[model samples]
Target chain A: MTNKRNQIKGFCRNVDEKKERLKKAFGYILKDKGFGNLGVNKVSLEAGISKNLIYRYFGDFKTLIEQYSEGIDYWTSQAEKRDYSEMTEKDVLKNLLGEQFNYLILNPEMRQLVLWGLHESNYNTTSLLKKRELFAERLILQKADKRFDGRIDYRGVVSVLMAAVYHLAAYSSVQKANFCGIDLSQDKGRKRVLDAINLILDNIYDLNEDKKKATNDNE
Target chain B: MTNKRNQIKGFCRNVDEKKERLKKAFGYILKDKGFGNLGVNKVSLEAGISKNLIYRYFGDFKTLIEQYSEGIDYWTSQAEKRDYSEMTEKDVLKNLLGEQFNYLILNPEMRQLVLWGLHESNYNTTSLLKKRELFAERLILQKADKRFDGRIDYRGVVSVLMAAVYHLAAYSSVQKANFCGIDLSQDKGRKRVLDAINLILDNIYDLNEDKKKATNDNE
Candidate 1:
């Protein structure tokens, strides 16, 4: 009985190790060659795992890709891990945007998915986008922040701000270019961008402090 | 001599037709299959033009793609055709952003390049992005209006607004998803976004009219 139990323990460890290796291989291939090269054969070759093992471990390439992709996407994985219990809804929204800016710049795999959404609208790209949209909806619209509605175009502002974050981070990461000569790729540009986001948010939310007071009084 | 002239004219007509055919094939392939399938062999096959002619007419694949891309990129082609001479610098900036928002939604080819910049940073994608950056830089920074400088973070603001436009346009064109429950792909959402952009600019520019007057008084 003891010998059988020890063998099972070793087998479970091996399975976990293989799964981790497969995921790493998936991300590496995504970063290296993008979706065009993300076939099961290519991934199996890259991972040094057999097709049978990939199917057995992760079911199929699509399942594996989605499962692995969920790990990299900010709204799906990283943002899900953050603790927003103590934060206000506005602060939470700001945190979401700030984290996405840094994540898109730093994470090439996520960046590739974001870029892939342009010309190629397939499961590989849309699924991640859907995940992001759904996640943000849950956080921003569903659970909290009904106070600011009709008072400001906060939704439009957030949409525009988030869009800019994705564009600047993804474009600048690859091309040493500028929008209006503001190269936000470098560190000096970081504070400027963050400050600008804060400034814009302040304009939309806090700048109308008296208006908010008037609304409160009327209510 | 008349017969000889007629033969030369027919030969030139065939050459022009063949070039146009090749360019059309290039765009179709880009739209249908994206860069992964956009090879000279494929384009030649699709166009039914010989490889030798593609070389003789357009030089090489890179040159052909670049030349073809220039025709489609807004800043390089369409925006270049616009008469912004009558407009003030701020108005010019507004027009630039507005045109881009509409164009990105309407033009899949340009949208593809904007989206492609996220993951695939190659000649096909980067060339278009470089063209846009240079055009905006020249228009926004070089030729006019340093009045807004030091008074505000217009560069940061523009960068953020432009970034959001890209993200919203490209993502919505595909996903039909909402950002903050605002389905900006619709016409009603268009006004909300445009108004938000105008409002942000007003907050940045006109809201500080008193401040500008104060600064002028100091001067």
Candidate 2:
């Protein structure tokens, strides 16, 4: 019984190693050829793992690709595990959006994946977008001050902000063009865009202040 | 000499007819199979015009596509010709954005083409995006009240708004999912989003008013 248990543990260790190798291979493939060229054969060849093992371990190519994608979650899979101690709602949004812009600009492969996601009928990509919205809800909408509730349409604001982020990333990735004369490819341009985002966020908070002031003035 | 002139006119007429046929075929193919499946063979087959005529008339499929795409310009092609007299600034923006949303929704072919344009390195598409910016500039920036300048980031505001429009249109086309609980697929959800957009626009104008009020109070 002791010998059998040890043998099973050894097998499990080998399986984990193979899974890690497969995942690393997928990253290499994704970085090299992007999401469009990713296939089981290429991954198997890159990882030096057999096709049978890939199938057996990950069930299918789609599942394996998804498993590999978790390492590069665009939204907040890794950040979800963190605590937001003492951070204002504004700070959270600024950092979150700023980080997203940097992440997309820095990681070409991720941008490609996201661009592919926008077009392809892939379940994992769709789910990832949905997950992103959920993360925004948890971080922004749910935590926003109650005083600014109706005055600030959190959902609309977030939606427009996110759309801006995604579009900027995608546009900068492909072309050297500017959105509204702000070239996102350059730092100055990017700063201007970020400032614009901050302005919008500030406007939301300011709306709350205006309401309060109006009431006080009347009183 | 008269016979020769008649012959020349006949030849010109034939060329125009073939060009029109090729252009129509390209549209049908785009609407049917999207930009991805568009090819010389597909266009030829659809147009019922020979490959020779296609090559002769357009020089190549790329040029042919570019020409076809100009007719379906996403911004300010047909709309540019319309009169915007007797409209407030807010009315102009609201109508412009609302029309954009409807145009994107109604024209799936255009959406796919726009999505393709975002990724692929096509000169025509790139030019179209530039033209789109110019359209926004003409409609929004050029028409915006100059007194509201500096105090309100009009360029940033327009950038974010255009980004929202493109991203929302692209997202709704590829997925059935809603953004921030707003189902863009449904009219009610779309209205909610449009309202959010209006609110943002209103905030920009309101900022100008507030600044003026503060100045007056200080005086």
Candidate 3:
């Protein structure tokens, strides 16, 4: 009975340690070679674990990949970490986009992943995008529609704004030269982009509110 | 005298034909294998022209690349073709941004080039970006400042809108998937983005105009 218990304890520790190792190896390959290189053999070799063991532990390599990616992807990671318990709907939306811009700028690996995701629309990337889309639908679209009450197309607003954040971060990461006279490389240039985003969002919020009030007055 | 003149004419025709062939090859490679696959040997091979002729004709490979790229790049190509002689400054600016969105959406090669341009920012892409920056400075920034004064940062507004246009077009070209609840693939979805763009641009124009009038009244 004592021997059996000790074996069980050892097995659990082994599984936990191996999972961590696999995650580190996945990240290393993802950064170095990009998403396409995350094959079973390469990852198993990098983790220095047996292929069968990895399969046995994760059930499938893709699950491990998805699990690993979710931790690093800004949407998945930040969704859990961000405290939006107190802010207004407008504030939460603004914060989400600004934080995304900051996160993509700071994380080169994440930027690379985004590039690959845009380039290739395989099962993996499509799946990743689906998660982000679902998040947007539930959080921004559904909620913003309720608050703004259809003053404007809220989805379109977020789409353009979110896309701008993604593109600027990706472009600025490499070039940092300029986009329409705005030098994204410089601190001043980046601030201008962020400020403009804030300004636009504020304008939108005001527009929604004013339109809302006008309708109320009319009634 | 007749023989010598005919020989000179024949040589000139040969050079023009070779230039066309080289341009075709460059486009072929740029679309097929991407920018990295563009090398002298491959272009020569595809064009069925001697490597020495390519060098002798263009003076250098980079010049050929730039020359070829300029014709396809939206800013360089459209600068010559677009009829903005009669439009107001506001109309022209709005049209430029909106046209870029339509152009990028329609041109897949342009989208691919954009992806590479963002990924790599060597002399080629930077120079390309420089041309765009110069155009913006000369055309938009200069005139916009004269018109709007210190009303708003026109550059920032343009940056977000332009980047969003690029991102959505590129993302839509490949994935055709929903981004933040906006599906860029469908016509209705695309119309939403374009409509939102016009609305945002109109708001900025009105804001700038309103601020300008307010300042003028005070003076």
Best-fitting candidate, scored by TM-score: 1
Prediction 3 global C-alpha lDDT: 0.81
Residue by residue across A177-211, what tens digits does model 1's lDDT show? 55667766687786678778877887777545656
In the range B90-209, model 3's lDDT, one tens digit per residue, is 677778777887898787667766776767777667787888888877766788777667679877887898888888887877785687777678878888887887778788887877
Compared with the real two-chain complex, what DockQ does model 3 have?
0.63
Global lDDT scores for all candidate models: 0.77, 0.76, 0.81
Which ten residues in a row are the worst by lDDT in model 3 chain B? Answer: B29-38
TM-score of chain B of each: 0.89, 0.84, 0.90
Question: What is the C-alpha lDDT profile of model 2 across A55-152, one tens digit per residue?
Answer: 89999887887776766776644557656667887888888887788788777667766766666557878777777767767777777746565666
lDDT of 2 by residue, B1-219 (tens): 999999999999999999999888888877766666778888898889899888888898778877777777656455677677778766877788778877887776677667666566577678777777776667666667475656676777767877788778767667777787667667777777778788888888888798878888999
True-structure lDDT of candidate 2: 0.76
RMSD of each: 2.5, 3.6, 2.9
Better of 1 and 3 by TM-score: 1
Name the better of 1 and 2 by DockQ.
Answer: 1
lDDT of 3 by residue, A144-213 (tens): 8888777798778778888899889878888956788777887788889888888888888778888999
Off by over 4 Å in 1: A142-145, A213-219, B142-145, B207-210, B217-219
True contacts kept of 1: 0.75
Which residue runs of candidate 3 sit more than 4 Å off their true CA positions?
A1-26, A29-65, B1-8, B35-45, B48-54, B216-219
